[model samples]
Target chain A: MLALIRSEWLKIRRSVIWLLLLVSPGLAGLIGLFGVREEQPGGPFPWLIALALMTALHAMLFLPLLTGVYAALVCRYEHAGGGWKQLLSLPVTRTRVYIVKFLFVMGLVALTQLLFLAVLLLIGTAKGGGGAIPWSELLGSVGRGWLACLPLAALQLAVSTAWSSFAAPLAVNVVFTIPNMLVANSADYAPYYPWVQPLLAMMPHQNGYDFGAFTLPSLTLLSVVMGSFVVFFLGGWAYFARKAV
Target chain B: MSLRILSAELLKIRRKFIWFLIFLGPIGVVGLQAVNFGLRYDYLVGKVYRDDLWGGLIENVTILMVPTLFIGLAILASMVAGIEHQTNSWKQTLALPVTRTQVFTGKFLLNLLLLLVSTTLVAAGTIVLGIVLGFGTGIPYGVLLKACYYPFLAIVPFIALQNWLSVTFQNQAFPLTVGIAGMVVSMFSIRFGDWFPWKWPYLINAAKEPLYSVACGLAFGLVVLAAGLAHFVRKDVK
Candidate 1:
């Protein structure tokens, strides 16, 4: 498992995915910085405002789509030229390999989340936010948003493993994810929908938006997040282990 | 020359999931509105008055569909290029009697055709969705036509750019990332002026004349297409 994880990390490090991951957050932060400035020059809850602006783009669409792309990139080399057979032929267990790849994708997503957090903080400070930094809100929203991406990574990995044409899983991801903006607003469906979890988790507190009203209670939110993580991770593992290379 | 290659390009996409994808773009966009209106029929309908309801429905669908169309076009371009990339047939196809320009033109036309089809589907689906929601069947023909098409015209530069990126990069993720970032920036650009290519799609319905955007899309799209094809012709295929 350790060896597989190391190899997976090596493969990703050599790719442009890391650099590309920064592009979305970097753009969001720039926009958010300008947004904070324009909204009354450090007005009420500037950190929350900056976060709202950041999450509005990042959590809603970029992160979900990026999750799919990262999973596909991690699996890209493996999906080519009997690469899976080559990897599985090693003494390493397929289950461990699958888990490790999934872990790497989650780790990449976490790095993106942390980068986004840094950008959010930087934007807040640069804009001279009026209030003391909302540490709990920042961490809770960013951290939970990252956590919400685990199930997506797992599901994307499963699809990536099954499809060799790199864009197939990605298109599928985009098709499913683009509706997050709408579905995340649904009072009845947002709580249970895995696709909308990141949006819900990343939403700023009392933002007076439709999404603000749609957030699940903490207990329900935790259950949904953890529950999806288990189901997708295990289901992906089972399919990968038995899938014909 | 162009027609033969166009048919060939279309044929290539058939064995792949490109058709399903072309259809998926509109279905996804219209389907979201279906659910949105289905759930909040009274609230949404109440928000808009009688005759204007049709325009409101088209407008609401257009707002959401812009991002969908942007992202969807990026995916379609990649998928079109990926068909050739996946098979390692680029060199083989290019080495044929057909010129690279013809091949590029065919691929570009195919992408345009797919976008047109998706746009048509969105227009049709919006009409269908509006009727089902009982928003009165008077269908604002002009608004509906513009809503369906203006974005497609406005998106030509982006389509050209994405096609270029996808065709050039063996790894599809780069173009996909660029497109996603474009979508993010485009969201913010709406507040800015209409100078940016990403902003063109939404700007078609701006308060000013819509032709300003349409003109930009045409001029810029051709320039980008020519530049991309030039590079594609010169670039060595592995």
Candidate 2:
């Protein structure tokens, strides 16, 4: 497992996935710096507004979409020129390899979330936000949002494993991801929809503005996130375990 | 320019899930509008009385279509290139009698044609969606078609740029990420001046005269295409 994780980490150094990280946070920062915020300059509790806007673009579409990209890339080399045959011929169990790749994707997503957090703080300070940073609230939302992405990461990994064409999994993810804007709007549908969960977790219910993250308990949120995560992870695991590759 | 290469490219995309993707965007856009109108018919028609509901429907559809168009083009470009990239077959394709420029042009044109087909579906689907919701006979065909199409005309520059990026990079993630970022920025593109290509799709609708975006799209598209083709032609094919 350790060896597998190390190899995955090394593969990323040559890949541009890290550079892709800068896109969403960078765009969100531009949006925060330029767009008019609801909070008066230096008003009390300014974190939520910046977070609200940033996460709307960040977690809602980009995060999930990025997950699919990362997942596909994780398997990109393996799909090329019998790389999978080379890798699997080794003694390592397929389960461990799958778990490690999934972990790497989750780690990449965490890095993205942390980048979002860093950008959030930088934007707040740059704008001369009045109050002290809402460290607990900001961290809490960001963490919850990352937690919500577990199921997505698992599912994307499965699809990426299934498809050799790099863009096919992404196409699948995008078709699902684009609807987050509309799905997140419907109170009846938002909670049940997996793609919309990260956005729901990141923004407080009151700030949702028809985002429909309201009235959900943390325990229920946790169960739903973990429940879907298990289903996807196990399904992907089963598929890979039996896959001809 | 060779009919041989162009037809070959079209044949390659069959059974490759590309057709489903071409159909997905139009249907998804129309489907979302159906839900929107179905649930809130009273709010859309009743509360905003005297406002042409057809115009309102187009407005709502534009918001969805603009992003869909941006992201869709990028994926199409990447998938087109990926057909070769997955097996390191660029050398195989370029070694043919066709010039590299011809191959690149074929991919870009096929993508543009696919989007054109999708856009027509959007126009047709929107009309059907409106009629199904009883939008009545006063269909604003001219404005609806313009709303559906002027953006495609104006967005040719972006099509070139996305094809450029996708062709240059073997990994599709970079181009796809850029496309998503473009989508995010396009949410704010209405505030952008006419010069920005990403803004052109949405701006075509808002501009008093739609031709402004058309001129920009064509002029910029050729330059980008030439630049991309030059790089593609000169670069060492792996």
Q: Which structure among the candidates has the greatest lDDT? A: 2
Provide per-model DockQ scores.
Answer: 0.75, 0.71
Using TM-score as the measure, the top candidate is 1
State each model's TM-score restricted to chain B: 0.95, 0.95
Chain B TM-score (model 1 vs. true structure): 0.95
Candidate 1 chain A weakest ten by summed lDDT: A36-45
The structural similarity of chain B in model 2 to the true chain B, as TM-score, is 0.95
| Model 1 CA lDDT for position A219 | 81
Give candidate 1's error at residue B123 in angstroms: 1.4
* CAPRI tier for the interface of model 2: medium
Off by over 4 Å in 1: A38-45, A129-131, A207-215, B204-207
For candidate 1, what is the TM-score?
A: 0.95
